[model samples]
Target chain A: MATTETVAGAAGEASQKGMPQLNFATWPNQIFWLVVALVIIYIVLTKIAMPRIAAVLAERKGTIGNDLAAAEELKSKAKAAEKAYNAALEQARADATKIIAATKAAIQKDLDVAMAAADVQISAKAAESEKRIAEIRAGAVAAVSEVARDTAGALVEALGGHADASAIEAAVSERLKG
Target chain B: MTVADQGLVIDPMHQFQIVPLFGGDTLTWYTPTNQTLWLGIAVAVISLLMIVGSSSKAVIPGRTQSISELLYTFIHNMVEEVTGHEGAKFFPYLMVLFTFIVTSNLLGLIPGAFAPTSHIAVTAVLALMVFLTVTLVGFYNKGIGFLGMFWVSSAPLALRPILALIEIISYFVRPLSHSIRLGGNIMAGHAVMKVFAGFAGVMGIASIVPIAAIAAIYGLELLVAVVQAYVFTILTCVYLRDAVGEAHH
Candidate 1:
């Protein structure tokens, strides 16, 4: 409530001024004082207090508007900062996936190379074992030939004693030649 | 001259008095007449209440505070609403003038009291204050150069002074007329009431009829009290029309 206290106060002041003048002042005297009071009060209200009050109100309005503008700016800045952070997080996730795929590929390549080397070693070992078995079989056949010659010589000697060794030997030699 | 031959010697308006501290030779302070003392007391009491009602007040008002503020606001709005926005500044003078008159008038109704407004001197001073305040407001807002409220500024220069002189005289008379109008009206109303009461007594049992009539008239006086306060305030606003600028009227 915009109270006119100054006016009320002015009246109180005038009343006090009024008291001394009651005995001393006539109608004219009172009128003169009343004029003086009115002029002074009007000047004070118009020049001093009223202007100051209006200025204060105007200043307050400007301050509130400034505050609103500042708040709006801050709100936008926060939104932009949030957007940047989300973009960075998304980029980090993409990088992590790429690294994981590369690791998987590397592990698979190592396993494939190891399996190929093992297959070659097994094939070479099998070929070497087949050659060694052929060599052992040849040695065994030579031993059997020597034993047969010796047995034949013994039989001819025995047959000489029994009178048919020379004729058996001649028939075996002819069959061998044919 | 003791002319109490038939009936009452008692004059309520007279016979009561308050002694004064200081002496004076001219318009001097002596024991004030009963009416003056009562009126002065009414003034002091009313002024004190207005002070109490408005000082260091709360935003949400209490009962006494609200009534005081309402009276203040009601007068303020009445001025503004009557005279439009330009009249806003005149609230100070109009408010003061209204409170002083209305308070004094209402006080006069208190059986043993008198209204200072019943005196030509007090009301004339009040009216004079309004007249001066408005004129000063007008002149201040419009410099000494803008005295065109009189005759047509468009009129030939030879005619301006004669017309302007008349306008100035009429303007000066505002206070005298305004004060008397109020003082006369209120004084008549009270005197008539007393006169009728005197009539009722003489008329005996027929006095009941006059008593009823007086009662109705008292009711009318109360209404007039409020109306006169309003009339005084409205005229202040209308007179203050030029307080801002000529366009304001």
Candidate 2:
């Protein structure tokens, strides 16, 4: 209650003194200070602060733009590298195919040459065996004729009949011919 | 006055008083006052924040530099959005108004500080300047066709005159409403806090209520401080759009 009374008293005093803000006399002073302050602030902001901030912003923008451009350049470079890698991969495949084909042809030629040499040796061995067979057959025929002649003489002596060697040979030869 | 008497006196309005800084028998136009000192302080602080803070112009901004840059972009985008590309020409003006008003409002939140924006003289002058500039630009750019802003071509021909009259009256009332809106809001917030503070003295142990109320109001005033500055600047841009905007026809 005592606090309220003091508050009222203070309010009364303030009212009695008149609100300085409402007082027309001080309006010009306040207005003058306001204008001066605003003008000064305006000049400072426009001339100094704003320009500095703008420069910073522009610098940041410029840096960002340059970064983007650099990124674009790098992206293109990477793409080119990828394309080259693909081209190299294709070339490697093509080269491998050529090497495989060349190896196959060389092996085929060597196989053909080896097969021809083996055929010639087999034919030569067959021809030599045929000649030896012919020689053996001729020797067998002579031995057979001599044995017939000896057999005929022994038969004639045992029988006490005369037998001629030339006649015996002629008879055996004629039989052989027939 | 005795100490008891002084302690009991709850003069909440006393904070708003403009006493001269130097002892003077007569208050003159040139007399330095608390308003001057605080205004100077605001200017100095803004200079420190903007000029000194951004002196390095670092690509990576420091604390003060970041604040300055943020404030610059915020107002820059606002002006661009509100008034289109041409509004950039008035960007510095809007920036100045926003920083001054917001800084002044925030500074005024300090105990025993004066809010320049709370004064009718200050807000009125600022509003008047906006009104005058918008008007002059409208006239200069659009010539007599500026008057067509009041005429609603879309309205029925029979009601066109009435609509135009209303528009004219509302247009003229722009400065009045603009000034009162800012000044009244700031003044009312401060006055309410003062009343709450007065109650604090009388409420004794229950002074907690009044103290809490003051705290809440202070928080609200902080929001109001920034919002009022934004409101004032955006409104300026809206009015400027009328001046430099492209014609529909």
Candidate 3:
């Protein structure tokens, strides 16, 4: 306690106030304190608080570096992802256009095929109708020739009995009625 | 209550009082009981750091445990600055020294805790150790002829003795200077803080000035604590150069 001084006590005191400048420390006592402080400080730093601080700082540094590296990786991945998305979009666009072209070709091909079939069927039906009309016309001409031949035969017979033109016309009319 | 009221005046500086362990040298150096207590506390704390750090020697550090490596690197870099390429070799010892001083200074700044460095004896011992080690290193590296450092090669032959003596005295004074710089600085800072605190107490309403001063001083003290540690380490580096450096080169 000789080494320790109370500032307030020493200052307030009248006679002893001047004694504050004096040092009463012994050599051995100073050495003892020296050794104790050194050894203790050495041991504590070597053992406890320093380790805590060291551990904390190292961890922080490592984590920060790791985070930075991870971020870099993520950025590359994102860029790659964007590129892939763009590529896929491009592929989709091309495929859509190609399909449209194919579809158009297919539709055009079908239309051409349908038109060819319809043309063939329509021509075939028209040819059959023309043949039918020619047969009916031939039959009508043959009927008129037959009627004229019969009328001439009746006129020649009527002339041998009375030679009357009126009788021939009446016979023809009667024949036509029967 | 005055001294008369309590029957005894309480010494505010009781914490710093030196109490003799025995009538004579107590285990080599004069030391008080409180100092012994502080030493034990310091040792315990430092030991705990070692245990925590060496717990797992993982390549990739995890948790707060990795701080051990950063401290290692910090001191390693400091040593390299002082010693160049050779500095890496002294990494462990340098790290140990830096961490110990830095932590001790920081611990002292804590309330009610004694800053061992504030005591001249403690700082003296550290400085002395540094001095002895650097000198031994010089001698070991350069042999007996390293004493030639005291004589500047360019000096005239007649002036050698005086120059040598001056150099020797300065050399002897290294530890004193090294110790005093740290101890004196810490003591004055603490004293100023105490004085400001007293002023604040005396003038309650206008105490903001002292409070502001205290705050500023506290910040400065923290900075000083770091700087002092660095200064001490740097000094060790400079001394080592003297120990191992070529005089002519």
Candidate 4:
């Protein structure tokens, strides 16, 4: 420690100008140079740096704002497009429903017409068959009566009596009536 | 009376010496000295950061550009915070002061480089400039009402005159404290480093301790350099509030 102090003291004495900072001789030179340095710095900054940086910052803010606005616009456009699509889809679905209902009604109408025609044709055929059956029954009855009359005549003739067709017919009718 | 004779080589104050750069016995005001060289270096560094670094004008700044921008925003905010919106006009001046001080302080940390900020003459000029500018701005903005800063209206009328006297003295002392604080901090750190380095030279194997201290103190000094610049600028802003801002006192 003593050696350190002595050396520092000795070095200080050798320099002979105690605390060179307080020395007034160099103050002018330092102040002049300091002024020059500051002026140069000031000019460089004001002229070149500040404006450029400020412009860049302002431009960035503008770009960000513009991009945000653009994004918002696009989003609204997409929403509008989606809404249009939905509306179209709804319209198509309603049209489809209407078409199906109309087709069903038309088909039902055609089916009703065809069924009525078929029913008329079936009823007409049934009525005509019934009339033909009645007619055949009447003819069968006449044939039977004719057979009986002939048989009665043969029997009378075989018994060696007069063969009377009118009387036989009248008696057979009376027996058939009973 | 030499370090060789004293068996220790510590000349802590020698670093503050303003010697001529060219071979000369006399130093004129315009004569370029080591002080001039370092000041020029400080200016170049400032230009590089402010001009070349930002030449890209990139919206998304590159590394150097970001650094310059960061410094810009930092100082800008400081001015705005202290001086309010009206003080924005002084932003360029404060930026110059900040960049110059911080650059020179950092440069001074180089083993043999002279730090202009370590000199009272340099810091006094800076503080005086701030003082004068603040005075000019105060008068310009408020006219005669600028003197209202010294008047303590909040105090009782009987005590106001005394308080005014105190305010006036403190206001004048601002430049002194402002310049000394920066110069003193820088000068002390550099001198301490030199003292430790001188110990390292004489301590043989034990010199590792002083060498280690120098390393540690170097880091502290780096912080000091930046902090002092900040302090100087912030104080400037605070003083500026009297000029540009409404007299809230």
Which regions of candidate 1 deviate over 4 angstroms? A1-178, B1-36, B55-60, B82-87, B152-170, B247-249
Candidate 1 has an lDDT of: 0.62
TM-score of chain A of 1: 0.48
Candidate 1 residue pairs in backbone clash: none
Off by over 4 Å in 2: A1-18, A118-178, B1-9, B247-249
Tens digits of per-residue lDDT, candidate 1, A10-116, equal: 33343434321232223433334334434543444344433433444455567778989999999999999999999999999999999999999998899889889
Q: How well is each residue in B102-221 modelled by candidate 1, as lDDT tens digits?
A: 877887777756666665666777787788887787788777744667655766889888877887797778787787788777776776677677767677788888788878888888
Model 4 clashing residue pairs (backbone): none
- The numbered model that scores best in DockQ is 4
User: On a 0 to 1 DockQ scale, where is model 1?
Assistant: 0.02
DockQ of each: 0.02, 0.26, 0.12, 0.32
Proportion of native contacts in model 2?
Answer: 0.54
Of the pair 3 and 4, which is ahead by lDDT?
4
Best by TM-score: 4
In angstroms, give how far residue B208 of model 1 lies from its true place: 1.3
Maximum-lDDT candidate: 4
Q: Would you list the C-alpha lDDT of every candidate in the order shown?
A: 0.62, 0.84, 0.67, 0.88
Provide chain B's TM-score, model 4.
0.96
Each prediction's TM-score against the native? 0.51, 0.80, 0.61, 0.82
Lowest summed lDDT window (length 10), candidate 2 chain A: A1-10
